[model samples]
Target: MTNITKENFDKAKNFYNFDTLYAPVLPGLKATVMKHQDAITDAFYKELANDEIAAKIVAGRVDQLKATHKVWMEELFNGEYGEAYFNRRYKIGETHVKAKIAPYFVEVITSSLRRSFAQILVAEGAVAVQAALAILDLDAMIIIGAYHEDRMHRMSDVTGMNLNLLETLMSFG
Candidate 1:
């Protein structure tokens, strides 16, 4: 997995326009998201439960998953997208890998999260929606990226090959 160094985190902040764009709207967005976070968490997990395999994957951990997801949901709006935040998001990816979740599930979860939050966020108006989305985008991107990186690293470790060679092999028909 990629290290969540300050430089990496700052680059993410810059790419997402965290200071100029996201920060201004985050306070209100945070308030709104916090107000509705329970609904968001419930909807997200409920969506997860609708899928047979996913439901099995989460079978015995719904409560724990809901609690962790609630924190992640609220944290997105908290306006503190720093190194610690990046590390936390990266850890989310690690957890997914450890759980043997397919990378495609990240996309599904992100979609579910968007569904759960979009209408309420839209009510906050365009700027707020955009800002909130920046955070969500960062969260999903980090999780997905970390998931792939860690998987690649694990493969490399097992095969005693460098990442570039592994990448080439993976790309083969």
Candidate 2:
């Protein structure tokens, strides 16, 4: 795993402008997000069920994935944006990569959940655009960070093998 420094995490938080305005509504956001968890998950799977790629990725495991996804949604709104939360997000991303799931599926599913969350928040009269966007942005960044890290690691291994082969061929020469 690529080590994400606290500085980098803090930088991201600041870059997203997740400031005092965002903190006040954390509890309310958590409640709202939790309340609509089922709807969000259902919508997510409904969309995935129609997508050939996504359906293939989740074939025969819809029930298990749905349960796991529910937990992920709960944790996302757990109101604890610490190292553990970040690590969980990173692992979720890494899991998708390792499972050979395409990145587009991840984006589509997450976007759906975000939209659901925004609608719930708006309906509850707690619309904070910056706060909402910041949450989504932070989650996206962590997930993408994991994906990039895994890709780079795989590429590095391939590069090393190529280099070793080149060195062996040059020795033969």
Error of 1 at 136 (Å): 0.7
On lDDT, the candidate that comes out on top is 1
Candidate 1 local lDDT, 116-154, one digit each (tens) = 566888876788777776777777788877776887888
What overall lDDT goes with each candidate model?
0.78, 0.72
Estimate, for each residue in 5-109, the C-alpha lDDT of model 2 and write its tens digit.
334566887775565556455655777677777878888888999988888988999889999988877666556787788888888888888898877777767
Q: Give me the runs in candidate 2 sitting further than 4 Å from their true place.
A: 4-8, 125-129, 161-173
Once fitted onto the true fold, the runs of candidate 1 whose alpha carbons sit more than 4 angstroms away are 3-12, 164-173
What is the model-wide C-alpha lDDT for candidate 1? 0.78
* Pairs with steric clashes in candidate 1: none
Residue 9, model 1: Cα distance from true site in angstroms: 5.8
TM-score of every candidate relative to the true structure:
0.84, 0.81
